[model samples]
Target: MTLDPQRLLRDLFDTAIAAAHPRQVLADQLPADRSGRAIVIGAGKAAAAMAQAIEEAWEGELSGLVVTRYGHGADCTRIEVVEAAHPVPDDAGERVARRVLELVSNLEESDRVIFLLSGGGSSLLALPAEGISLSDKQAINKALLRSGAHIGEMNCVRKHLSAIKGGRLAKACWPATVYTYAISDVPGDQATVIASGPTVADPTTSAQALEILARYGIEIPENVRAWLNDPRSETVKPGDPCLSRSHFQLIARPQQSLDAAAHRVRAAGLTPLILGDLEGEAREVAKVHAGIARQIALHGQPIEPPCVILSGGETTVTVRGNGRGGRNAEFLLGLTEALNGLPGVYALAGDTDGIDGSEDNAGALMTPDSLERAAACGVSAAERLADNDGYGFFAALDDLIVTGPTRTNVNDFRAILVLERHTDDH
Candidate 1:
């Protein structure tokens, strides 16, 4: 088969995305026995897409509301799709969150609530706990994003501060059963971590959430601190009566997406080495991947050339610089700098959701001559890295991969393709 690095990498990403899409995973996960009337509610980048899938598969009277990030909306006759903010809370999210709680409330034991969840749901369903305000949630959310906290830690704090998350939604169903179908974007694929586990019982506590804030040196609001100290901020815990009727299922996950990408790469005639879902500081993780790629190129310890290294997981950025780049772009920039323009190394890192750190582009691509192209354009690789300007650096070389609103997110997708080494290639 002919080799086109850019096309192959992008195709692999698309294939992985297709594998986790609601259409691919939701139908099989539909309820086998409908013991009650169904009401659907969800919040996330993929909620609208999930709603569409539910409408297409289920044969019943379904009506509900869901919130999704703007531009990710899909037409659903039964499920009303509302656009909201993400990675940060907004008034729109705040209002829709209240409606979701009301919709699930007052249901009988014979009623069932179908909740669709995915990455970005945490921010999309932003309803502050008692004594807290939307602005307060927004402030804490911004701090969490900039504090370099991982998704789990961020959601821990969010669940404690939320009125609907951390199993509160399920609690509202009372004797009714709440069925939660989630697409996992976190490292461990824990049901409790995805979208802050709106319908799943949380084992984490308010005290732990406060501790995470302190660990990250994030400043907590006076009321938020007071609420955290009080028991009212506590999420629904395990063995609670509210959780007995909750049914959680992971229909899609990051590792599954990674495996799907690897399968496609192998089918295309290149050996694929899946590194599994990874997490950490983007640059630090890039350094590790850079070392592995270097080993394969210089010594071939792991495998010979013509192999693609793939991984999926959410990476963090401290946001020290005012650079316009997401974690994936930062990872590629860090990888590029660490590789130092090594021959036969090409890569692409992107969020599966088609948005990277609130940027328009999905992510960026890197080639052996990427640095050279930047140099010719008078963009210093080191300086760009210093400013956390990976997006700018790649944009200068016309290497950004832009795909608008894929509607489904399984977290970060990274590919490092190492071609066969030659003496002259060096």
Candidate 2:
């Protein structure tokens, strides 16, 4: 059967998104009704949908606020959904952060807080620590993004610089039972790292956060510096009593999305293989992907023709030049180069949130002839890689995938589709 590559790719993308949709998956996980007054709070691309899910599923007196990235808010009744900036914190984020903290502070022992945490929450819940301002945190966050630090490292600094993160929000709901439902966007699904672990115990220290800042050459304001120097400014540590009544539950994750995509691939008359979820360094990951594709093309050791290899996880990019790129773009450019016009191999890599490293494109698509097409358009794959402008290269070819506000983030989704070649073009 002849395969329509575009339609197949679109179907796979839809599958990934469907696997992580809060509206479809969140309701079943929440408690039917809490023993006390229930308040719903959340942050991330999926925050609004998560709120809607709670309102529809939980039969209780629910009241609270949820903050999501701009353009990701969903329609809801009891839960107040607020739109704010992401990747970088803004005034709207700061305002909501303060308000959420305030809401938690007045909770009584008979009350319960239902926290819906997800990716991008760290930036959305941006209440600067006592002496720090939102602008200060924003600057530091920007620097961290360009510094090649992984999400975990960046969030560590964020937790220390915020008044609402690092379990501080949970601390405020001291007398209340805080129940957290999270969508894991970080590698390993570390509870403490997801959304800066607003309701989980922090194993990091102010000194550690300060060290990360120092490594990135980020200058902290005098007040922030003083706070870091003082041991009393520490975030909630392991065994902190303030978190004694809290519970964290992971509702969705990258592996589940990858598995779902693989299932669809098999159902479409192809063998499905998962290439593992955890990965690092976009270029390196691309090289590994290319090697696997090459093996399938030549020896067919791992699998035969008509197969799809899937993977999910966050990858890092070391920014050495000024380029309109992101980790997803970098991976695509590298994959395109390695394929070198090989026949019948197509691949797609994208951030599940529909945004690739703050760029307009979710990710880029690479066909077997991607390099040739790029060359014909006067776009050199090697040069684009050097400039760190993969996004620009793909944009010029109109190969960038644009999905506005998916309202969910599960890190990156990668798929390589191999079809039987009628002719030996290799």
Candidate 3:
């Protein structure tokens, strides 16, 4: 009960990250080595870590490549761990992705392909469809990101425009069994939506992808539009013979991480109310969380004080301004604004991958005096939030939580700590 709120919340966040680390979860989910060679191809924040785990556990010929966000790489002797751009595709990603296709292509039935997938895979595996340039994909990625499209919607568009995603990777390894190990960062953990389901059958269609783009008002070149209209652009669907040998399993998930954090909360003598892996617009979600925290603190209708409200999942942000912040930072800022300096309340929001929205920091923290502290520095929480500059806002107050790449991703982790009720107005 006497634990420092900051330390306690940070401890909880650490617990969640550890629970989802590839080293902790990938080893168990790895399928028994297939009869032949083991070729690992993966992309995401955890791809390199997953490869490292495979090298430690497997007793066979291991070879292949994986692409991760720059600085998220792990050392692997056999499997090459390549780093690339994320939230935006770059030449490095494109180069590595082509290499991955070559590695998996022409594989025999006796060979096994272990495809590691996690958050950021969509951008890390940046193979644009035929006639679609990398810059084109880059532009679309930026637009979708700024348009506030949910992961699924953005991925739907990505799937149709990618040569490697949406089951194409599995198809490239046709005749060879594909074993996909994934760390879930997407809401609902749908394999088809995670990293655009590189190795799993995509139920989403090209038209759906086009519709998503249109719904978001994303403009595309005529060539890209024509590709979507073509039948060949459609992703491999369920029951496709190419994916007959494909198998998938979730190695780690946001909910499991949240559950781990919740366990830590209980051990601290605080109640843990976990809001399931939820997703939506970042600020909007923060507003809802603030409401729950206020209710518990003021009315105690749902839970008493000295409790932590935990939630996890990916949230989107519609970029209306040129601001420097990720969704988690934005969420923290939004929560701070909504709380209106409610006493005895503290919160931390971060991404398990250690980076949020192109920012170096994992996220930021918000204490009861968060707004006041910002005000003292001539920083207006309302103004910063309006500018979508959560990183800048928190940076000024020195509240940004900077955890260099954790090398694993389970999406966003948020905690609202309500220690006591300060408002007496009923």
Candidate 4:
């Protein structure tokens, strides 16, 4: 049987996504019956779907609100689904986040609040802290995206700047039992980093947020800086009474998704080497993958040929140019350049949620001849990479993978298929 590397790689991505779908993993994680009201609140790319999952599985009276990216809403009867901007907060998210805080406030001890947290939740639940405006928060978020800051660093700052994040939401729930079911996106699945840890105790400090901003050279507005410096803006810490009653569970994570993909690869009679949910700048991560692929092809050191290298985790791209593409595209572009059309090697990098950066495509694919084909089409891979135009480069080759919102996110899914090295001997 002829092996279609592209198909295999894509299949692995699908397996990874399917493993994290809310319907598949959430129902089992829900809490049992509570005497008081059951209120569900959440924000993220997967918020709406998770709310729907709870509505389907729990046969109790439940009502609440959840904010998801504009196009990623799922049908829920009791819980209200609010569409909002992501990767950056908007007024819509602010409005809904306020309502979420109000709903859980002054609740009784018997009341239960199920918070469906996921990636993008930090922006989705955008409630600026006192003295900070939405515009201020937006500006800082945009700067962080372009500043090449990692998710942890960005969230560390976001937690300090927000009113509802960094365990404040759980604090608002007060005496109510807060049950947080999160779909992990950040590396290591740190509960506090996922959506800024709306329901979990935040160990990150305001001083740390200030240091991250300084380290990234991100200029902060006067008021925002003052708020970060204020001791009152600190998040709920471990052993805090507000979060004492809250129980957090990571229902889905990047490593689990990678394992699912690896299972599929093994079923295909191919050895799978998981790179362990790598995290770094996109271009740097791509170079690392390329180095590994080259090693396997040239020396067969890590593993023999006819193997699939799998990795998962989020990677950030510092936009140097007004380019159109997400981090996945940037990674592929870098990988393509490094691979230089090495024979019998193909790869795919995509976000599990089906969107890469702010673009419509999930990600893109690269074959051994990607560079040669791009040149034929009058497209320069290196130039595109310089301009951070991965989407443009791949679009020109009709290689962009366009899967409209998968409604689930486990960060990035990357797979490189390395086949047997070919030798020319006639």
Candidate 5:
């Protein structure tokens, strides 16, 4: 039976996404309702869907608000959902950030604040510190995205410059019992890093945030820099009374999603080798994956042919070119070049959130004939890549995967299927 690579890859992606859906993972993680009011407050790509799940599962009275990326919101009768900008903050996000603070502020001991945090929450909950303006925050955030800093490092800086991030939101909840349900998007799934750890105690200090900024050469406004230098601008640290009432739960993660895809690969009679959730610069990471694929095809070291390699985790792009693509596209473009259209190997790289960077497509796919197809279509793969135009390269061939807003994020999903070597070839 001839294997349908595209169908299989899409199925694997779908399976990974289904595994992390809030409805499937959240019901069991929710804390039992107490005597006080249950307030649901959150911000992320999946906040609305998570809020909807809470509304369906909770038996007691629950009311509050959550902010998600524009077009990522789900329908919820209660627990109002507000849509805002992602990857960058806007006035809507800032307004909702204030509202979230207000909802949890001055809460009683009996009150319960449930925070549904996922990837992209950091940007969605954009409340600059006292000395910093929103414009300053926006400028810094735009710089950070283009600066190629990893999520942890970017969020480290974000935590110190914000009023509500890095456990300050938990501090605002005060005596209320805070239950935080997180969908992990960062490497190692550190509870304190996802969505900038709004409800969890942050271990990253202001000094570290300053160091990261310096390391990345990201300049901040004068007031913002002064604020970071001040000790009072530090985020909530460990063992603080503000965090005493907080309970953090990791409901879903990248590894779990990868495992789901791995299972589907096995069911399809392909050896599933999960290359354990990689994290690095996107282009460099792609070259590494390409090297592995070549090794498998040549000597069959690591894992033999007819095997499928799967990986998940976020990758960064330095944004050197005026290209129209996100990290995933850049990764795939790098992979395509490294492979040189090697026969019997096909791959796909996509952001699980259904949007790769600011592009309309999730990511792109590459087949053994990808380069040939690009050439045939008068698209110079090498030149496009040099210009950091992965979207244009893939779009020319109509190979971009456009799944509009999966509503949940577990970082990037990547799959490479290596078929058996042909005896007639080489």
Candidate 6:
């Protein structure tokens, strides 16, 4: 192929982003104008963009508010967009979350409540339980981040500790027809796991939340501890009457984004082999992918050379040290080490939201000489991997990709390109 590799990669990334752009995917799924007012309330990296989409699409009277991470907000006409701290709760988040919950209250059956949920909403829509201050929630959220807990576990604790999450938001909508349009950021796209299922019934128990806290060695305040220990704090479970009229739809997902990227790769005169949506420890996933890519390059078993292997899903990082890296970076670092100068293999892994685990860099790139570059600089890839300093390694090499707030999130997108070795000419 005569295509410039960098340009081809950029095009594939853009295609993935376009497929998950809230304005494009969510607008088509909104409920048609009925004889009622449409009130939108949501939180996530894409909340503001989703709100903007609703404003542009809905013909009837539309008014609502949404919360998104700082720098992730888009301009909207009617829907008020609030910027909040992410992966941790802050006062800005608390205020906006309260507003969203209160906005849905007092809605009648004639009114329709539209919830635009997406990744990062758990923190964007923070509303600490009674007697639990935002500071407390913030502390716990930070602890969870470093605890190596999966998204599902983190959100379980989030649901029980918040006043607005779980099914409380749906309960606030009362007799209103509550419709939730979510962009899946969690594995399996479970409704209750996305944004802690603010408008959906939570099947998790408060006891389970407590267990997570204990597992992470997180100490809640006396009052907060008591609340979680009590059954009263448990989120509304399945069969709750409050959620009878609640409706949910998954508008965008990691798989769709991956497929979009794969399509673009194939269009660029390359084959596309998609790895199924995967999750777990970032380094382990990277090792597995490296093996597969090596196989493709040598044996061409699973896939032929001159192809790109694409995958998407969220990955977790077990923070063993105070490293300035996210899971995606960690994965790239591990992959680089595993490849060990394997020729003609290039890879890119990035979180679709433009941020990876609270870091500025979206992710890192790996080239065939990645290990050589590290060795030349006296950097031990093994040492960095052990310290969870993936970002530091890439930053030293200037190989980090920083895209600054894509305004949408569909979890992580990974691509490993294997090129065939050229034959020597006579």
lDDT of each residue in 1-426, candidate 1, tens digit only:
679988888898898888888989998988886443689999899999999999988887889999999999999998899999988989999999999989888888888889999999999999999999998888888998999999999999999999988988899888888888998888989988999988888999999999999999989779999999998888998899888888988999988888888889889899999898888999999999999998888877589889999998889998888788999999999999898889888999999899999999999999988888888999988898889899999998889989999889999999999987645325
Error of 3 at 270 (Å): 0.5
* TM-score, cand. 5 vs. native: 0.98
lDDT of 2 by residue, 335-408 (tens): 89877878888988888899898788889898877888878899999988988899988988889999987888
Show the colliding residue pairs in model 1: none
TM-score, candidate 6, is 0.95
| Better lDDT candidate (2, 4) | 4
Q: RMSD per prediction, one decimal? A: 1.3, 1.8, 1.3, 1.6, 1.4, 2.4
Which portions of model 6 show Cα errors greater than 4 Å?
34-36, 421-426
Candidate 4 residue 330 C-alpha distance from true site, Å: 0.5
Alpha-carbon runs more than 4 Å astray in model 3: 33-36, 423-426
Could you tell me which 10 consecutive residues in candidate 1 have the lowest summed lDDT?
417-426
User: Ten residues in a row with the worst lDDT in model 2?
Assistant: 417-426
- Please list the residue runs of candidate 2 whose C-alpha ends up more than 4 Å from where it truly belongs after superposition: 34-36, 421-426
**Model 6 lDDT tens row, 75-99:** 9988999999987778899998878
Candidate 3 lands at a TM-score of 0.98
Poorest lDDT segment (10 consecutive residues) of candidate 5: 417-426
Query: What's the lDDT for all of these models?
Result: 0.90, 0.86, 0.90, 0.91, 0.90, 0.86
Compared with the true structure, what per-residue lDDT tens digits does model 5 show for residues 55-145? 8898888899999999999999989999999888999999999998988888899888889999999999999999788899898889989
The candidate that achieves the highest lDDT relative to the unseen native structure: 4
**Model 5 lDDT on a 0 to 1 scale:** 0.90
